[model samples]
Target: MSSKRMATIMGVTYGIAAIMPFFVGDIRFIMHILIMCLIWAVVASCWDLIMGFAGIFSFGQVAFFVIGAYTSAILSVQWNVPSVVAILLAGVFTAGMGVIVGLPCLKLAGPYVALVTFGVHMTLMPVLRGEIGIALGSGGSQGILTIPPVNILGYTFSSANQIPTFYFTLFLSVVCTVIILAVIKSYWGTAFLALKDSEEFAMSLGVSAFKYKLMVFALTSFLTGVMGAFYGHYIGMLSTRMLELDLFCTLMVMLVVGGIGRFPGAILGAFITVTANELLAPLGAYRAVTLGALVVLLVLLLPNGVMGLWLKRSDAEA
Candidate 1:
């Protein structure tokens, strides 16, 4: 679809989501699902930048996520800064760290990059707890609480009103999606894909492999950091444990099930996975079993995720 048409469709979808609570009697539940899905959708999209587009799979993304969340929380709580400023700064901070991490870590690809990221996560887990965290007032093991919700203009958004939080997240998510799509459609994105296929070949074609790799990493890190910051505010907390391996694994599963190289695949994966988690919440003990079954089914059946299947059918029809 053309960019204009795409924007219109997204705008309509977001409008529906933003006002969905009013139609549904259970505003809390609706908001919960929308907010959660939006957050993960952004994260999943950022994952697409490294793993999906660039073909660099790094598991330690959550570490940068935690950094963004903690940084925004600390700044808001201690310095009394606006969430917007905090989010922007968090992106910058995370992007800077991405360079530090990417330079040495990007040197290793495939499973090696994933291992390095896992190691990074393992190293950060301890430092984010108790006294060490207390020095930074991160609440460490206990996690930080009473985090301030986003305040825009004269309006304040707390956990009480779902509209503001839902809209805010939706806006950020859409913005991230647009930014990513734009980048991917550009020569820079072409460079990323080139490197993914063959770094040496990309360099030979006048594409600066190092430059594009670093750029993509920085861009992905910035978006991930923003996701973390918004998540911290919306959830009203932050912790080291929340940035666990299990979470990344689940995210990776979502991406793989969604279709790694495709944009729509990543989003469709987030939506389906989030919806499944919510719908199965009532199942309690059986929820995990159900989710596993669904994943297995999707892998064997869809294989390329819902969007991937749709695309294939479309192509076949054409």
Candidate 2:
């Protein structure tokens, strides 16, 4: 997508979000959902950046997110660090973890890469509940409780100050969104598309697959980590429950519904999927089944997802 076009899309997506509080300000549940959508949109966009654009079949996004959340929670609770610094530190830590994992796994084939990444997600539960986790203030199996809200100067982004929290999250989301858009419009994005088109040919054209792929992967991990830390602070706790396949599948649904490789679509998908998940809440246990069915339907009927449909219409009109 052209820079101008993508910017317009982001503006609209975030524009709607900016105005959302005015209508639903009284409904705390809706406000909470909106905040979550903002949070997940960045994470989902990062996933799209890697898998959709860079063509890396990484299944470790949730792992990185959980890592970031725990890292921030531990930093503030155990070490007495400020929440702002803790969030950034958590991002850096997660990015380093991504590099550690990526340096080895990026050399593997697609499915193998997915397996290794997914392995990270799977093993995290035990690791957090073990001795090492306790040493780092992971709270072991009990998880980190009593996490303080993100405090800026004298202000706390607690639920008690919902308006400020909403705007605060939105501000972070905007920064991440602009960064994602900027990456896609820059040489890095061009290189990623080249690598995706044909890694061998792109490599022959002097694109270093290892160099570009690993860098973008780390960048995505960093963003996901930051948002994850925000979530931990906002919720006031951290737990291994985040690693469940159910959450993983839900993240996948965001990408699939948005149209993998589709930039703003992932953003839109996050909003739609988060809201839909809430609607499906009444279904209780059947929610997962319903989401699975929805995915299958989107795959078979609209393989490109909602973005694909929009693109098809645009093409026809043109």
TM-score of each: 0.91, 0.96
Per-residue alpha-carbon lDDT of candidate 1 for residues 1-318, written as tens digits (9 for 90 to 100): 234543554465556666676776266876787887778777887887788788887776788888889988988987888987887898899899888788876578689988887777787778878577789878768888878887878676656777777777788888898888788878877888888988888888898867887897799889999899888887788878776666776677668677777664676577778887778999999987888888888878866665455454653232
Worst 10 residues of 1 by lDDT: 309-318
Off by over 4 Å in 1: 1-16, 312-318
How many clashes does each candidate structure show, in the order listed? 0, 0
Q: Report the Cα lDDT for residue 141, model 2.
A: 87
Q: What is the lDDT for 52 in model 2? A: 86
lDDT of 2 by residue, 212-279 (tens): 98898799999999999999999999899999887898899999888888787899889988999999
